[model samples]
Target: MAGQDDERGHDERGQDDERGEGDERGQGASAPATWRRFARERVAQRRFAARQLAELRGYAGRGLVAGTVAVHLVAGLAPVAFMLGTGLALRDLGSDAAIGWLALAAGAFLVQQLVAPVQLVLSRRVQRRVDAACIERLATFSLRGASLAGLERPEVADRLSQADEAFEQWTLTPGAAVEGALALTARYTQLVGSLVVLTWAAGPWAALAGALVAIIARLGQTEAFHRWGDVIRSLAPLRRRANYVRELATGTRAAKEIRTLGLVDWLDDRYVAENRAVLDTLWTRRRAVYGAPFVAYTVAALIGSVIGLLVVARADVDVAAVSVAVQALILCGRFGVIFPESDVKLVYGRGAWQALLELEDIARRTGPEPAAAAPGARLTPQRSVRLDDVRFGYTTDRAVLDGLDLDLPVGTSTALIGVNGAGKTTLVKLLTGMYTPQSGAVRIDGEDLRTLDVDAWQAAFAITFQDYLRYELPLRENVAMAAIAHRDDDEGIRAELERVGLGSLLAELPDGLDTPLTRALPGGRDLSGGQWQRLALARALFAVRHGASVLVLDEPTAQLDARGEAEFYDTFLELTRGVTSLVISHRFSTVRRADRIVVLDGGRVTEAGTHDELVATGGQYARMFDVQARRFADEAGAGSPDEPDDPFDHSAAAGAGATGGAR
Candidate 1:
C-alpha cells in the first residue's frame, strides 16, 4: 500500500513536471488568452449593466432615481457604523463615554429603519414600471422588420423566451438587482467590520477560515447552477408542452371543443401529468445545486466552534474582548450565508439580463428592414404585382420555394392552385410583406416589394385567410379592423355587412352593429361558423371599400356547406369584379370561374391558362378536374349522364381565358 501511494505521488509529480514545461512554453499564449477572456467578460458585464440602468431610467425619473440611490447609500453604511458603536457601548458601559457610543448606535439603527420604507416603496414602483416598459419595448421591437426570419432563429427565440419569462414573474427585476447590489454594500460593510474586530480580538486565522468558507460556498453554488444549464435547456420542449396543456385547460377558444369532445378530464389529466414532469425535472437537479453549499456551511460552523474553544482556553483573554470576538465571528458566519445567496441571485439574474441584451444586439444586426419606404409611399397597385425569382424557406435544410416566379395582373381575378405543401401559403405571406424572401424581388408595379413601406404594402391588399381570427370584439369592431383608417364610418360598416349578405345577422343583433361578438363579454353573442365566414368576407370587402385594391381570399369558403360554396362561387365574380383578386381554393368548383388559373407543384408553376385551355392541354389541371368530375358523376349514379368537365357553370368569359395548368 505504501509503495502504491509513493508511486502514485511520483506519477503525479511527473505529470505536474510535464504540465509545467507545457505551461512555460505556452505562457506567452496563455496570458493573452486569459486576459482576453477576462476582458470579454468584463465588457459584457459593463454593457449589460449599462443597459439595465438605461432601462431603469425609462421607468424612473432622474430625481426619483437619485433619491433611491441616496436612501440605499445611507442604509448600506448604517450597519457597519452601528456595529462599531454597539461594540464600543457594550465594552465601555461603566464609563460616561458609553453614552455617546449608545447614542450613535441608536441613531444609526433608527436612521436605517426610517429610510427602509421609502426605499421599499421606490423599489416596488420601479419594479412595476421597469417590467412593463421593458416587456412592451421588446414586443414592439419583435414585431418590427418585414421578415419573420429573425423570430425563427434559435438564438432570437431563446432570448425572447428569457425576456418573456422574466416579464411573466420574477424573483428579481433590474430594480431588485440594483437594490440587492446596494444590499451587497451593506453585507460587505458588516463583513469587513467583523473581520477587523475578530482579528484584533481573537486572531487573523479565524478571519481567514470565514473568508475561505464564503468563497467556497459561493463558488460551489454558482458552479452547480451553471452545470444544470444544459439540463434546463434540454427540458425546453417539455416545458413548452406543459405550458400548452396549462393553457388548453384554461383557454376560452378551446373550451367549446373540449366540452363537446369530452376532453375536459383528459385535458386536466394531461396538464397534471405535464406539471409533474416539470416538477420532477426541477427536483432532480436540486441536489446538485444545494449539496456543495450545504457542505461548506457545515464546515464553516465547525471551524467557528473551534475558534470559540480556542478563545475560551486562553487565560489571557478578557471577558469583554471575548464577547466582542464572539459577536464578530457571528457576523462573519452570517455574512458567509448572506453573500452566497447574493451571489446566486446575481448569477441567474445576470444570465437572464444577458439573454435580453444579446437579443437586442442581434436585432440591431440584419434588422429594422432598411428597405421599408416612407409612410406616405403610394399603396395603390397600378400595373401588377410580381414575385421575381423568389426563394424562401422556414428552415435551412428544406427550401419551400425554389426559384418560383409568378405574376398577378392588375384588376384580374387569378386563381392559384396547388396540392398540399406546394408553398401556396408562403407565397401569400411573401406578397403581403409578412415575410421577406431570402432572395427575390416582390415587385409592385415597378417598385420592389422590400423597398415598399410595410403599412402601405399591407394597405394595398385585403386578405381573408383559411384560419381567420374571430376577434371577441363588438360586431362593428370585427368589421372595423379592416377599415381602421375609416373606423368611424358606421354607415360604411352596415353597407359592407349587407354586401356580404350579413344584413340579416345585423338585424338580429341585440345592439345591431354595436353588439359584442363573444359570450365572454357582457351581453355578447357568438356567431355560427357560416355567419363568421360571412363576417370575415365583410371585413375584406370593407378593406376594398376603404381603398384596398387587391383582394386575397385563401380558402374563404371552407366552412360553408356545398350549397353555400356553390352559391358563393356563382356570385364571386360579381362580388369581386374590377378588383385584382387572387383566390386560393381547394374546391375546384369555386375557382373554376377565375379569369386565369395557375397550377403550382412542389413550389413551381407547373401550368397556367384558362380552365378550357388547361382542360384542352389534358395536363395536371385537366387530370384533377376530370377526377373531380368523375367523382360527382359516380356519386350521383353510373347510369347518370357524365357531368361537364368544368367545375363551375359560369359563362365563357370566366372560364375561356385560363392560361394553362401545367407546362
Candidate 2:
C-alpha cells in the first residue's frame, strides 16, 4: 500500500511538470510580442535623448559646440599618444631616436595637462548659454496660452515643478547635459584609441576580448543609471511636496503664521517626515539599482586585467611592447568606470530636458484656439459690452456662473453689487478676456468676443481689482506701468496721482516720482494701506488718460475710511464721466452714486435699475440694503456720542441718507 502511495505521488509530480511546460508553450506567442514592445520603448528613449542633445547643442551655438568638441577630442587622444611615444622611447633606448621619442612623450603629457583646463572653460561657457536659453524657452512655453485656464491645470504645475528642479544645485540642467555629452564623447573616443593601441601591442583576439569586457561593463552601469533615473522621476511629486513643506517652514511669506500659530514644531516635523520618506525610498532604490553593477563590474575588471597581463607576459614581446600593452589596458579600464560628469549628469539632465519637452507639447495642445479675427483688429466698443447666457466654472462639478446675462452700456457707470461668491469677479474676468465662458458669448459692440483680438480688447480697459498689485518700483513706474507708452510722461503721472488725491504723498516722497515704493530698496518708502489704494487708483486713472476707454473698479475703496471712501467716490464719478465704468462693491453707500446698480445672485443678474428704483422695488437689493442700514444704525447707536465717529465705520448716516436718495 505504501509503495502504491509513493508511486501515485511520483505520477502527480510528473503531471505537474508537464502542466508547467504546457503553460510555457501556451504563452510562447506573447514572448515575441513582449520583446517587440521593449525594443520600441528602447528606440523611443534613445530618440528622445538624441533630441535633447540636439537642443543643447543648438542652445550652445555651433561655434562654441565645435570648439568644445575639438578640445575634448584632443584631450581624449593625449593619453594614447603619451603611451605610444613612451613605448617608442623605450624601444629606441641608447639610440639617437630615443631623445626624439622622449620629446614626443613630453609633448603629449603637456597636451593632456593643458587640454583639461581649456575644456573646462569651454564647457562653462556652453553651460551659461544653455541655462539662459532654457530659462527663456520655459517662460515662452509657460505663457503660450492666452487664457489662464491652461496654466492652472495641476499637470502643468507639476511639469513646471520638474523643469524648475533641473536648475537646482547638483541637479542636471540643460547646460550640464551639453557639457556631459561633450565629456561622454571624449570618454568614448579615448576608449576607441585605447582599443586600437591594445590591438597593435597584443593581438586582435586579445583586443576583442578586452573590448567585449569593456562594453559589457559599460552596459551594466548604463542600465543601473537608467533605473536610478526612473526612481528619481517616480519620486518627483513626493519631492515637490517635500520642497513645499520646506519652503513653508523657511520662507518669509509664512514666517509670521508659523511663529504666531506655534506651528514651527509642527511644520518642522511634517517637513522632516516628508524628506525622510523621500531619502528612505531613494536609498533603498539606489542600493538595489547600483549594487549588482558595482560588484559585477569590479570582479569583471579584475579578471579582465589579470587575463590581459598574462597574455602580454606569455607573448614574445619586448619590454616596450609590454609597457604599451599595460598602459592601453589601464586606459581601457576607464571605459568601464562611472564618470559623474558624463554618465550621471547626462542621464539625469536628459530626464529634465524630456520633461520640458513634454510640458511644451502639453502647452501647445491645450493652448487657446487661433484668433478668429485678424491680429491687428482692435475692439473699440461703440454700443456696449454684453454677456449673453454665459456659463463658466473653475471645475466641472459645479458652475460659478450659470446662464448669466448682463450688459454694460457704453459711456455709463454700472455698479455690480453682490454677496461673496456671487460670481462678481468671474464676470469681470470674462469681460477682460482673462477667461472664456464655457458656453454662451461675450459681445463687444455686437461682435462675438471670441472673434475679436483678446489683447486689443483687454488693452481698452483700465481696471483696479480689490487685490491690486503694489509694485515695488519707482512711483513713476508704479503708475505708468498701466500704460507703458506713457512711462516717459512724468507730468501725466503726477497729474493722475493728484486726481487720485496722492499729490501730497508724492511731494512727501524723498525722490518724488523717482522714489521706490518699498523699503527694501535704497531711499525707498513704504505707504499706508490708504496710500496704496490711492496709488492703485492713480494707475487706473493713468491708463484712462492714455486711451483706455473703460474703467472697472472692484472694491476699489476697501482700504479707505468711510469719509475717504465717500470723498473718493464723488471724485471718481466726476473723473470717470463719459468713460464706460463698471464698479463692483459690497458698500451700498458708495455704489449708490452710480447711474445703474445691478445685483448679482445665483450667477445671474437678479436686480437691475437705479439704486433708488431697486430700493423702492422691495426685492433682494432692497432687503440687503435695509439689512446693512439697520446694522450700521445699531453700531452708531451703541457708540458713545462723546467719542467721535470711527473713521473706518460703515456710517449709519450714509446708509440712512442713501435709502432716501439724499446724495
Candidate 3:
C-alpha cells in the first residue's frame, strides 16, 4: 500500500510538471521579468471594461441607460443628503432656523430610504437585459472562427477559461460594471460634499486628509485583492485535480470501475488530502494578504479620529460645525474601507473580464477575417482531399501526427484503423478542417485549403465522433442539428432516420419525431447505446441530404456490442452510398468490408488496400486483423457470416458444451 502511494505521488509530481510547463515557459526567459506585464494587464483590464460598456450601450439602448442612471442619480445623493441635514441641524442649533434645519434633515433621510428601493428595482431590470446580451456576445465571439484550432492554443484556452469564470462569478458582466460605475459616482459625489463641509468647518488640511485617506485605502484594497486572485489562479490545477478525484468516487460512470478495482479507499483518501491541501493553502494565503490591510485600516481609522478631535478642540471652529465635520469624516471612512467578501468578488471578476478581452484580441490578431469571403465561399473537393506532410502536436514535446500524408479521393469510403495514440482522430480532425496542420497543406481539388473559407469548408462534411454528445432535445431537432442550414426538413429527417435503421427506435419513442432525448426533461426518454448510434448516423445522413459531400464516422461503434456493430456495418454502407465517407474504427470486423483499409502507425500511413488485398499482403493490417479475429473465433465461434449470435458472447459456447456432454 505504501509502495502504491509512493508510485501515485511520483506520478502526480510528473503530471504537475507537465501541466505547469505552459506557465513556466513564459517565466523561464529572462529570470521572471513581471513589472511590464502587470502594467500591461492593468491597461488591458481598463480596455475590457470599456468594451463591456460599449456592449452594454448596444444591448440596453440609450434610453434604458439614461433612465437607469437618472434613478441612480437620485439614489447616489444619499451621502450628500445626510451631510446637508446634519450640517443644517447643527449650525442653526437654537432658533426657528434650527427647526427648519431639523425638518430638512428628516426630509433628506426619508428621500434616501424611498429612492434606494426604486434604484434597486430599476437596476435589476437593466441588469437582466445587459447580462443576457453580454453572455450572448461572448458565446458569439467564441464561435467566430468555426475551427477547433483556436481551442488548441494554450493562450486561447486560458482566455476561454477566464471568460467562463467571469460569467459564472459575475465579476465582469456589463450589468455589474454599470452598477459599479453608478456606485462609484455616488460615493465620489458624497466625498465632494464631505470635503466642502470639512474645509468650511476646519481648513484645507482636514478636507485634503479625507480625500487622501480614501484614495490610499481604495488603492491598497485593490492591490491586496489582486494578490489574492493570483494565489487562487496558481492553485487552479490543484482544484481541478481534486474535483477529478471527487468525480471518480461519486460519479455514476465510475461506479463499476470503483467496485471492480477496489479504488474507493484510495479515491476517498486522495479526495480528503486534496481538499485539506486546498483549505490549508487558502487560509495561509488569506492570512498573508489580509494581515497588512487590517493594520492599515486600523491606523487610518485612528488617525481620522484624532484629526476630528483636534478640529473639535479648535476655538475658531464652532462646536456645531465641528460636529458636522466629524460626521463627514466618519462617512469617508465607511466609503473608503473595502469588505473582503464582496470587494474580492469584484477583483476576480475584473481579472476574468480582462482575460476574455485579451483572448478576443489574440484571436482577432491571429485569425483575421480574409478579404476574399473565405468564410462564405465553398471549395468542393471533387477530385480529392490531401494532407501533404502534415505535422501537429498538443504540446511541444510530443507530436501526435508528424509529417503524415494521406489522400481521400471523392466518392470513396476509406476505413482508417490504428491503435490508440496512432493519430486516427487527429487525421480526421485535420481532414474535416477542424484543425490546420503546422507544416502541411490540406488541399482540396488541388487548391490550398487555407485559401477557402474555413466555415464554408466545414459545411462540406458530416461527422459523428465516438464520444458523440446526447443533447437533451427533441428527436427531430437532434437529427436536424446536422443540417442546421435546412433544419425545417421534417420529411428529410424521417427519411434519413429510416435509412440509418432508426425506424423501429422512433416508433418506440412516445412522441415520434418530437420525443425528447434525455430523462432529465419532462416527457423525455433516453435510448440504448445502439439506438443512439443509429440516431447519430441519421444526423450525418441528414447533413448529406442537405448538401454535405462527405461523411466521417470516427470509431462510432466503440461503445456497441458485437451484434450491434455487425448490424451497423450492414446498414452503414447502404445509408452512405456515393457520399465520400471515412470510417475510423479499431475493430477489424466492419473495417474488412470497406472499399479500402488504410493502416496508420507512428503518425503515418503504413499500408492501404482492400481487406482481401491487405490480408493477402500479410502486412501490418493483416497482423492486426488476425489477432482480433482469433479472439472471436476461439471463444464463441460466432464471427463468420453464417453465425447468427454475438461473436464476443460466450453463451453459445457454454450451450454447445452442455449439449455435447448430454449426448
Candidate 4:
C-alpha cells in the first residue's frame, strides 16, 4: 500500500507540474553585500530575507524588476538630455552645429515618448509575477508542516496579516515609486550638466550657491520621512479597522447572516466610524511628515531666487550668459523639489522593504514546508489506529482532553457519542492525525501518526464532518472532488449524486450536470441546507466507493427529517458494509446500530458496549436513550399516534418465508 501510494503521489506531482501549480522561487538578492550590515544583531534576519527573496526571484524570474528599472532610467534620461542639448544649442544660436544638436535632441525626446508605453506594460507583468510568487509561497509553507493550532495563535494571526497583502503593495505602488526615484536621479543629472554648462558660461560661485540650496532642501525631506515611518506604524490599528469594515461588507460568508439579521445599519455605521478613523490617522500623520518640509521648501526657494539675482547683477556676465544662468536656475529650483521628494520616497521604500523582509522571515521559519518530518519516517501505518495516554489542551489553563487511551480495530464499525465540548471532535482530529497529542501517541496501524507521511496517511480516509464544505461548483464536480482520481469520470460523479437522492434535483436544473450550484454566479442557483448536506455526504461516499477503506460519517443526517434521517442511517451502514467505520452522532437511534458504541464524557470513555447491552446496564447510554425515546413518544402521542411495528411478527413471517412454509 505504501509503494502504491508513492506511485500515486508521483503521478500527482507530474500532474501539478503540467498544471503549473507549485510554488515559484522568490526574487531577492543573495550577494554577501546584500545580507551584510553594520548592525550585527540584524545579520541573521537579513540573511534570511536575502535567501527568501532569492528563492522568490528564481520562480518569478530575474528580468522584471531590473529590466523595468533599466528601461525607466533610459526613458527618464532621454527627455533631460534633450532639454540640456536644446539649452546648449540656444547658447550657440548662429552656428550650423547648433541646428544639428537641436535635431538630435528632438529625436532623443521622441524615442523617450515611444519607450514609455512599452515600459509600462512590462512593469505591470513583473508586478503580477511578484504577487503570484508571494501567494504560492504562503500556500506551500502554510500546508507543509504548520499545524492548524499554530494558525489559531494570536501572534500567528498578526504575522499572517502582516505578510498577507503587505508584499502586494511593493508590486502595486512601490515599483512605480522606485521608478520615480530613478526619474528624480535623471533630473538631477540633467540639472548638474546644465549647471556645468552655465558655470562655463558665467562664474563658478553662482553654481556653488544653487547646489547648496538643493542639497539642504533634499536633506531636510529625508529627516521628515523618518518621522513619517514611525507615525504610519503607530496608525496600524485604524488601517486594520478600515480593512475589516471592507471585509465585513464584501465577504460572502458574512453577507448571508448579516442581511438575514438586518445588520445593515450597524455594519454601515461601523464602516463609517472606521473610515473616519482612517482619515483622521492619515490627516495627522501627513501633517506631521509634510508640515516642516513645506516651511523648509518655501524658505529655500526664496534663498535660491536671491542667489540667482546676485549672480545676474554682476557686470562681468553677458546677456547670453545671464539667459543660460536663468535656465540653470529654473532647472535647479525644480531639482530642489524633485530631489527632496525622491529622498522621502527612498525612505518609504526602505521601510516597506524592511517590513517585507520581516514578514518573509516569519513565513520561512513557520512556513508549510519545514524539513520533511524526521528522516526514515515514511508515514505508513500498519496496525489499527490507537491513542495512548494522550493529553491535550486548547489553551494553557484549560485542558480539553486528558490521558485518554483507545485502540480502534481495523475493518470494524465503532460509534462515538458525547455531549457538546466533550472532546468528541478533538478525538476525531487526533485519530485522523490533524493535531498531535501534547504528551502521548496517536498511532496508525502500529506506526506513530506523527512520524507517518502526513499527506499520504490522510489521503487514506473519506470523512464527512458536520461542517463540510458546500462548494459553489456543479453538483458533479462537488462529489467528484472527493475522489481526485475520479474527478473527470462523468458517469461515476453522477452515480454518486444519484445515490444521495440528488438525481431528480440534478435533472430538474437548467443545464442538468453543468449547472453551477451558487447564487453568486450567473445562471447559478442555491440549494437548501439539507440539500447541501446530502451533497456533502455524496462527496464522502464517492471517496469510499473508490479506494478509501476508512470512512468517517460525522453527524451525516444532522439536517434530515426524521424519516430521512432513518433512511440515511440505513444507507450509510450499507455503504460502509465491509469497511472500517467510525461514526459520531448525538442521536442514539442512529448510533445504536453500530457494531460497537463508545460513550465519551469529559474526554474519557464512560462506557463501551453494543446498544442492547448498554441499555440493559442502565448507565449513561441508557439515560440518554430514554430521554430521546420519551421525547419521540410524547411527540407521537400528543397528536396523531405513529404507526408501531410488530417486531416478532415480522421476524416470524421472514423465518416462515425462508423455510418455504407458513406455520
Q: What is the C-alpha lDDT of each candidate?
A: 0.70, 0.79, 0.69, 0.65
Mind sharing the TM-score for model 3?
0.81
- Model 1 RMSD in Å is 8.8
Ranking by lDDT: 2, 1, 3, 4
Per-prediction tally of clashes: 11, 0, 2, 19
Report the C-alpha displacement of residue 657, candidate 1, in angstroms.
21
Model 3 lDDT per residue over 246-334, tens place: 87787666888888999888888889999988889999999988887757865775686566556546637776777777877776666
lDDT of 1 by residue, 615-649 (tens): 89999888987766655545445433554444354
In model 1, the runs with Cα more than 4 Å from the true position are 1-64, 94-96, 153-159, 170-179, 189-234, 255-277, 297-325, 338-351, 358-378, 395-398, 511-514, 562-578, 630-663
Q: Model 4: how far is 16 from its true place, Å?
A: 46
- Clash count (model 4, backbone only): 19
Cα-based RMSD of candidate 3: 9.0
- In model 4, the Cα lDDT at residue 382 comes to 42
- Which scores greater on lDDT, model 2 or model 3? 2
**Relative to the unseen true structure, what is the C-alpha lDDT of residue 383 in candidate 2, on a scale of 0 to 100?**
91
Ranking by TM-score: 2, 3, 1, 4
Can you give the lDDT of residue 301 in candidate 3?
59
Could you give candidate 4's per-residue lDDT for residues 281-353 as a string of tens digits?
7897788678876687768766976786587567286665676677666666665453542454444443443
